[model samples]
Target: MPVSKPLRKALQHTADECIDCGKCMTYCRFLAESGSPLSIALTALSADENVDALSHRTYDCSACGLCSAVCPVNAEPDNIFTELRYHAQANGIFKLDQYAPLLNYERLGQRFPFKGESLPEGCTTVFFPGCTLPAMFPDATRIAFKILKRNNPKTGLVLNCCSKPSKMLGLKSKYEESLSALVHTLERKGIKKILTACPNCHVTFKQFNTRLEIVSIYEELKKSSFLPVTPSVKEVTVHDPCVTRSEDSIHKAVRELLKAMGVRVLEMKHNKSNTLCCGEGGGTNMHNNAYARNWSRKRINEAQRTGVPMATYCAGCVNFLGSDYPTAHILDLLLVKRKSIPKPVAFPFNYLNRLIFRFTAL
Candidate 1:
C-alpha cells in the first residue's frame, strides 16, 4: 500500500531534519531500540526495513509525546509513528490477538453500554467524569459531580467515553465515528463547555472536538470551596498525567488545590510538559507488559525519592501507579481523604461500578 499523505509528510520531515542528536531517546526505550526517527525514516523510505518489525516498533511507542518534546528540530517522530500505525492497521499489516480484550473494552465505551447524562434546563456545561474514574471509584465520581453541581448549578453530568482507545489503537474510522457522536451529542445538548475529570478526555475534546470548550474539573474545583479537611498529610509529589503534559494551567490548579488543603507539593525531576508516562500510554502494554511497567517503574522511582505519597489528577494514573507506591487521585484526596490507594478494580466490578453510577449519580 502507498504511504498516506500524513505519514509520508512526517517521514519526509524527519528525514530532512532530525540530525540524529539522540536527545529524544534519553528517556524512551522504544526510541533506543528503534533508533532515531531520522534513521527509521531513511531506512523505511529506502525500503531497507522490514515492514512488520517497523510497525511493531511504532506501536511500542508510548505516544507520550516525549520524543517531540525533546527534539530540537521538532521533527515530531511520534506523529510519524502514529500515522504509520494508522496506515498499517488500515492496510491489514497490523494485527495482534492480544489486543482482543482492549478492543472489546473500547467497543463497550463506544456503545454507550453504561452512559448517563444530566442536562437540566439552564445547564450549558457538563462535568465529564470519564470512564476509569466512575468505573473504579463511583463514590469519588459522585463526590466530584456533587462538588461540580454545588459549585455551579448550571453544571451537568455526561458519562460518555472519549473514544481515545480507538484513537490510540489507530482505528481512524472508528475514532472519527465515535468522536463525531460525542460532538453531536454535546451540540444537541447545547453544552458550550466540558469540565473533564480525566486528563485523557480533556486532551481528546481539546484535540478532536473543538466545537465545545474543554476545561479540567480540577480547574473547576480550584474555583470553588471544598469541604474543609484537617491535614493528616503534610507533603505529596504530584504525578502530572502525561496526557496533560502541555496543560500547565491544569497542573497549577491541582497544586493550588493541594496547597489549599495545607499539603506541601514536591516537584518530580521530570514534570509539566516533560512529565513521565504512567506506563499506560499508547496501549503499549497490550503489546508488551514489561515495556509498559518499565515506564511505570521509572515514575515510581522518581516519586520514591521524595519519600512522600504521590497525588495525581487522573484516576487511571492512580490505578497504574498505586501498586508500587501510595498514589491517589486528587478527587480521592479531596473528597474521600484517602491515605492509602485502593486496589485496582477488575473488569466486571469496574463495569458494575459504572452501571451503579448510572442509576445513583446521574
Candidate 2:
C-alpha cells in the first residue's frame, strides 16, 4: 500500500529533522536493527525502494515512545513508525494469523458478553475495569469498583474493553469508529468521567475523547476506600506501565498509596516517564514474539536490580511478565494481599473468569 498523506508528512518531518544522534537506540532494539530515524525515513520515502520491503521493520516496533522521549531534536520516530503500521494494515500486508488475538479482542469491544455495566442512581461517573485486568484478576476488578463506589456514591461499575488493541493494530478507520461508538455509549449512559485501571485504556480514551474526563484508578484510589493492605513484600521494585509514562500524577499516586501502606518502593533504573514496555505494547507481541519477549526480559532484569519483588499497576504487565520474576499488580496487593505473586491465568480460564466475575458482580 502507498504511504498516505499523514504518514508521508510524519516521515518527511523525521527525514528532515532527525540528526542521527542515536539516543533513541540506547534502549530499544527495533531502532538498532532499522538504523536512525533519518535513514529509515529516507529508505521508506525514497522513490526507488518499495515501502512493502519495510513491513516487517515497521511491525517490529513496540511503539512505546522511547524513541520520541530520548530524541534531542524531538523527531518522534515512533510516531513515524505508527503511521507506517497503519499503512501496512491498510495495504493488506500484515499477516492475519499473526494478529488473530488482537483482532479477536477488538471484535468483542462493546458486544462483549461480560460487559455488565452498572450505573448508580444519578451516576455520572464509572469505574472502568478494562479487558486484561478483568480477565486475569476478576476479584481485584470487583474490589476496585467496590472501593470507588464506597468513596463516591455516584461512581458505578462498567466492565468494558477500551479497544486499545484496535488502536495499536493500526485499524485507522475502524479504530475511529470504535472510539466514536464508545463516546456515544457513555453519552447515552450519562457518563462524564472514567476511572480506569488499565493504562492503555486511560491513554486511548484520552487520545480521542474531549468531553469525558479520563483519570487513572491509581489517582482515584488515593481518595477512595480500600482495605488496609499488610503488604506481602515490604520492599519492592515498581514497574510503571508505558501509557502512564508522562502522567506524573499517576506515578505519584501509586507511590503514595504504597507509602501509606508502609511498603517501601525500591526504584528501578527505568521508572516513571522512562519506563520500558511490558512486551505487550502496540500489539507487537501478537505480530513479533521475539521483540515482545525482549521487552519483557528488559523489564524483568530491571526488577532484579533492586533484588525485590515487583509491583505494577497494569494487569497486562502481571500477565506478560509471568513467573520469570516476582511481579504482582498493585490492586492485588491492596485488595487480595496474597503472600506471593499470582501466576497468570491461561487463555480459556481467563475468559471464563471474566464471565463469572461479570455474572457474580451483577
Q: Which stretches of candidate 2 lie over 4 Å from their true place?
A: none
Task: Report, for every candidate in turn, its global Cα lDDT versus the true structure.
Answer: 0.83, 0.82
lDDT, candidate 1, at 158: 81
TM-score against truth, every candidate: 0.95, 0.95
lDDT of 2 by residue, 38-126 (tens): 89888888862456667556778898898887788978787788887787778877755777877786576467586668887898998
Cα RMSD of all models vs. native, in order, equals: 1.8, 1.6
Model 1 Cα lDDT, one tens digit per residue, 1-362: 66777777888899998999999888999888889888898877776234445765677888899888788988888888888788778777778577887777666765565776888898999988788898878887888888888878888888878888888878888888888888887888788998898898999889884779888888888888777455446899999989888898998989999999888999999988899999999888888778799999999999999999888988788878887788877787777755465667877898898888888876
- Collision pairs in model 2: none
Give the C-alpha miss distance for residue 164 in model 1, angstroms.
0.3
